[model samples]
Target: MLDNFPFYLGLLIIILLLIMLANKIKVAYPVLLVLAGLAISFFPGVPVIKIDPELIFFIFLPPLLYEAAWTVSWKQMWRWRRIITSFAFIVVFVSAFSVAIVANYFIPGFSLALGFVLGAIVSPPDAVSAGAILKFVKVPKTLSSILEGESLLNDASSLIIFRFAMIAVATEQFIFYKAAISFSWMVFGGVAIGLLIGWLFMKAHKYLPTDANLDIFLSLLTPYIIYLAAEEVHSSGVLAVVSCGLLLSNNRHRFLSSKSRLQSLNVWESLCFILNGLVFMLIGLDLPEITKGLEETSLMTAIGYGVLITFVLIISRIISSYGAVIVTLIARNFITVADNRNPGYKTPFILGWTGMRGVVSLAAALSIPVYLNNGNGFPQRNLILFITFIVILLTLLIQGLTLPYFIKKIKLNDIYDPVPRHEAANHLKQELAEFVLDYLKTNYEGQTEHNPSLQHLIQKWEQHIKGIDNEIISQDHKHIYLDLIIQQRKWLINKNKEDQTLDESIIRRQMHYLDIEEEKLRYI
Candidate 1:
């Protein structure tokens, strides 16, 4: 471990540099990190990095999924439940079986079960990757919410299918009824365990002393505990973590102290950044190890297989997305209580196009057994790993890089304008100010000791109300004030983009100040 210190330190430095470069070039940092890791793999003195599948499933996955779930809006998730569920479960099943059939027909010795394994491996798109890219490009909130909700839950379905596939491959038996029962149990049990754990944790936080540091520490531990507890009972640990996160996040405003909430956000954000960078880079570094023993299959042949399967995966997603929309439209006629907000064609197209695979796919591929129960070697194991890696690389490079352009071409940003947001915020502020002034005047006007303070507070609230009501000065002055702040923020962002000399921390600090100023203006 001590001997690896220099290497780890150097890796951290490289990740930082790659992130800066990504910001300058307006590309997602994960893409750059993967490229950097791939480049570093060929360095003369560097040792090959092997990814531990267990580490990813047990360590990295829980927290990442939990953090994502925590940040997602539960209200939006409810509104888009039908769309999200269709994408998460139905689309995953469709994509998996579709790829399975294609892989079985195309690859010489690949069994149908193994094909399903590969399908399951590549079925779910990485939420982290999508979230990171979406952060830079402005998409509609509904689209973002749908993508986020689908990603949060799809892993459970994918992994469940993967488990059944692995069992079928190893035992040479498939039991459909038993598998269906087990799937339901896993999902429902996971949710029950998660809600129980989340409720217990919520009680603890509510009753405990309000120590920000302690609360943050507990927040970090929540995911791991929830995951382990659920998995111990053979339940879906992924669902458990996600459920726990959503429950806690939904209740955070009521139970958590303000300082704890702020500190926890900062802590989680930093942790996510480091983990995401490391995971993507690790994906690239593992390429050398994954390709080591592929002497049986020619590289070109494997590449051909990968390209075919990648095409299949993309096409399957596109078809499934539209199919889902059509099915929803038909079902809406019968189910009157369903979400009636039709997402239209463009949204589904964008959603289908964003199905880029990431680290989880690689981890699942790597986890494939080396030997079967009959003591024979796992058929085409190395080739499967190789193909999986190729799919990851192709999708990340091809789909991830071009998704923003597609969003722009569709004019999604323009469609989801911020004018309504500003209007609603201003309206809320005016109503709040008016309510406060009315309460003060009615309750405290006759009190002698509180008269002066009450009058002063009432005047302040009235002045704010008047300022909001004053249309002539309000519109022009507010616009100028907002414009100046926005201009300064843009300059800082552009400086960071143009010259890589400025530290990202400086830009982040400046951006934070601008955000605060903009937030303050919402009241006026």
Candidate 2:
């Protein structure tokens, strides 16, 4: 490892600002940062910095996965367990085996074992990529949940397969029965370690009285605990990280105090952004190193190979999704009153197309062992990395850019409107507001004939309710009034006025309480 602190620091600062701009411009931050990094490579007097792939996986991935898992709802995730399991377990293994078939047939000098290795790495979708792109899209909750859950769980399955694949490649030995037994041990051992560690962590939090900073620090440590525990047992650290994230997230309400929850959220959100930026930038930077190995091959040949590999990767995913859908449908038919209905033909097709390759693919490609024994370089290492990068750029930059238009063409937009959902949510808010007002009126200290202001406020709320019932008030207009309420509350809080304008004070307090309440309302 080289220090080159000045160069690395300058690059990081530039990347941070560039990422912020990319977000405002509504472009994918990863792709943009990657492009910027690629451009940086050509600069005069730039020193090349080499990093170990092992460091990135061990140091960076756990926290990122933890952040994603923490924010997702356990109940919602559990509801989609069937589809998640199908995608994570079944889809991953199928995709790996399918890619192995294609790779063995077409790619020269690439072994079946190596093909399976590539398959394992590329099978899991990147959580960061999914989170980033899905942020701006208007997708249904079920679809979003399926994507996130799949992203989290597939990392484990992919790693498990990759482990076996690596063993076969390194030892030049392959046995289906041995591989199956090893896979079971790896997966179950990782899961058991995660559960035991998570339980211990939860119990520790109970003894450690909840404080904002303490909880935030603990939140940071939980992922590393899971990663280390799993690794100690030679299991998939990725799975352990994900499982621990889920376990801790599910118990946060019970173990972490409200203040601690807010602090932890803020901490993790900031951490995720920095980590994501660096990872994407690294992906771009590594492209130069990958391209260096392509000097011997003709440009046309390389492009042809890249295209063929990309096609195989893309097709494997699409075929696997369709297969999973058919199997799930058949399984559902046997159950009485099973609610796991398939989306209309169009939705599954749309989902199949949205399976874009990204960071996981890039990382896996680069992770290909560069040296084996007897002075021979890792077989097809550079080629694997090159093809993987090409596939990621094509899927993420090309298909990702076109996804919104595809959705529009297929009328997926009409199927996934936020407006109606927001309207229903607004109705719930109004009802809650009324409930609070009623409770205060019945139980509060102030009830007087002298207070004309109090009576006017009550009359205003009743009239508002009447207007809502009569369809005289629009949800959009009510949203505007809520904005005014927020502004008024902010002004009062800034002025440190607890008792100014009695009705407004009560309203402001209610708004403050609701602000706290809505912390639990996290969703796309």
Candidate 3:
């Protein structure tokens, strides 16, 4: 494999080309990458790609989860906490059991435990796939938030189930109480460790001597450190990375320099794309190997099983989604819910239809130990891998292709936020401008008399408040501008917490601009 570095490099070149082609053709790149890899795998002399489970779990999963945590709004996550948790924990558990029952009954020699192993591998919808497809279709903010938030945590829950199932299969026993206790510890313990580490890192960033480069390096190191710490204690590493990432993200302004924050974002964005792209391409490339590994079941039979289970996943998720709606409607009767009225079925159905599987399933399917603890080969390992591949390929194609249609046909009017996104953004800016103007006038009215830059900032805010061009400048007057930015940020932060209607993301965007402005004022 080391000697084949050039070949691997060439393959990546081809993968990037195919991705570009996918964009031009208006098809999702994951689908095309799979198709391209499949075609490449069949070519003479092309090595059958093998996935290293450790590589996927450690190298890939943590950073991806961390980036997602940074992007997702904490406020939104809290608002839709019930729905997100149900989908992440409840729906994943149900979906896994649904597959387990179906596989155990239908697949020859497949035990319920082994069935659960397969179920856990494939149950959680891949974050990469959902994010890719969501952009293609316009959906309600709440629905997208639910899906994104679910994807972040579902991986952790599914992996937990996968671990337990592997243990059950190895030991030929299932201890319900012990497993339940372990699950609790993993979830809560992971979060606790994450918060602890997050606080430490936050303080380090604030007090430690660090520039943009060092900050970016620490940002990269953060998820891996948190993940390793949590997993070392037999807790959920995925949750740890997520929780820590969210903590850092929320408090970024407190610590990270504006340049560091922006640079870190760009670096993570590129890294995520490369990692996800490589796996998607590898999915296509690994098919021939996964296909050839099957000895217990015929390729056609395995594919048939894959198709059957894929449908099962779809149906179960749809039912669970509707079930969630029903439960939400009922629970709202006794408890406080955002909307008590019978929340209709369209949104729930859309959520249900979006249960596509991807890279994690591929990695988990391959992660199955080739030989069990007793030395005999793992049963139906090839079949599992093949089915997982089929599920990924089929889901990416079927759901990915059809999601736009479903969204279009459903005619979803699920408007959780009455304020349009653009309008909300504009309103936020107006309020900020007004506040800044007041703050400047109140604190430094006479101080700006000799300072042209500060005066310019004040005048710009006044014109911006009047709906004129809002271009504002602040080059010199470093101390004055910095102080003013700090004051405005404090007000904006307080204002955001006070008004629930204003989108947190809009606040973040404004916060981001302030970061840039402050960075310039301080350094340049």
The top-ranked prediction according to lDDT is 3
C-alpha root-mean-square deviation, each candidate: 9.1, 8.8, 1.9
Deviation of model 3 at 327, angstroms: 0.2
TM-score-based ranking, best first? Answer: 3, 1, 2
Error of 3 at 34 (Å): 1.6
Q: Model 2 clash tally?
A: 0
lDDT of 1: 0.81
- Give the CA lDDT, 0 to 100, for residue 430 in model 1: 62
Give the C-alpha lDDT of model 2. 0.69
lDDT of 3 at 210: 95
- Rate residue 428 of model 3 by lDDT: 79
* Regions more than 4 Å wrong, model 3: 448-455, 470-476, 522-524
Model 1, C-alpha of 338: deviation from truth (Å): 5.6
* Candidate 2, pairs of clashing residues: none
* lDDT by residue for model 1 (250-276), tens: 677457765676668889999988888
Candidate 2 segments whose C-alpha is farther than 4 A from its true place: 1-3, 294-296, 336-342, 373-376, 413-419, 430-524
On a 0 to 1 TM-score scale, where does candidate 1 land against the true structure? 0.87
Cα misplacement distance, residue 385 of candidate 1 (Å)? 1.3
Please, what are the lDDT tens digits per residue for candidate 2 over residues 1-524? 25688888898898889978877877667768777877887787777645467657778888988887776655556666777888888888887887788888887877999989878877776667666776666666657767888888888888788878888888899899988787887788877788788888888787867567877777788888789878887887877777778898766545765556666667888898888888878777776677888756665677777777667766777777777777778877786322454455667665666666766667666677778764667787777777777777767776566666666577554544333555544554465546535643664326525555455545555664554332132332344334434443444343333422122223334444544533432320
TM-score of 2: 0.81
lDDT of 3: 0.86
Between candidates 1 and 3, which one is better according to lDDT?
3
